[model samples]
Target: MINIQLLNKDFESRVRLGIMSILMVRDWVEFKELKELLDITDGNLASHAGALEKNQYLQVRKEFVGKKPRTTYAVTQLGRKSFQDHLAALEKLLGQP
Candidate 1:
């Protein structure tokens, strides 16, 4: 019988994967920065980000930069640890451990 269990899934969805991938690399990133990295549309990024924020895995800050609005995101401590664990699991699953 083939197993149907999920294995080493870093994210529940692809958009979330992209977000986590970026966060895993940098200490902090701007909203636009993530958008550019994933090449995803604004709405798409927003939706994905919303989910992350809801989980408290990402922290968001909004501020004004000389009359311009700017938004930035940083991975929370929990996020960093979680992503690391996820990666480790993936490596093990792929026989890379």
Candidate 2:
């Protein structure tokens, strides 16, 4: 039987999934750093981040550092739980657990 629970609609996109994956391991990530790592344009990254933020899956913080505005993103507790569940589902589908 197929495991429909393995699918996470919110994480279906490669970009979003990548973002969450990175956030899972890091404390926080700078906007530019994520953009560079994802090799995506400013607008593209913003759109993806916005979606995650809107879903309350991540938190966005904007601060001025030495007169430069810095925007950072971090996964929320809810996000971490959800991502872990999604990963578990995938592992189950793969018969790893």
Q: Candidate 2, residues 37-76: lDDT per residue as tens digits?
A: 9999999889999999999999999999999999999999
Off by over 4 Å in 1: 1-10
Q: Name the lDDT of candidate 2.
A: 0.92
Per-candidate RMSD, Å: 3.2, 1.9
Segments in model 2 whose C-alpha atoms lie over 4 Å from true places: none
Q: What are the per-residue Cα lDDT tens digits for candidate 1 across 1-97?
A: 3222434343767788789888877877888889998899999998878877887778989999999998888888887777677666666657642
Minimum summed lDDT over a 10-residue window in model 1 is located at 1-10
Worst 10 residues of 2 by lDDT: 88-97
* Model number with the top lDDT: 2
lDDT values, one for every candidate: 0.78, 0.92
Q: How do all models score by TM-score? A: 0.81, 0.91
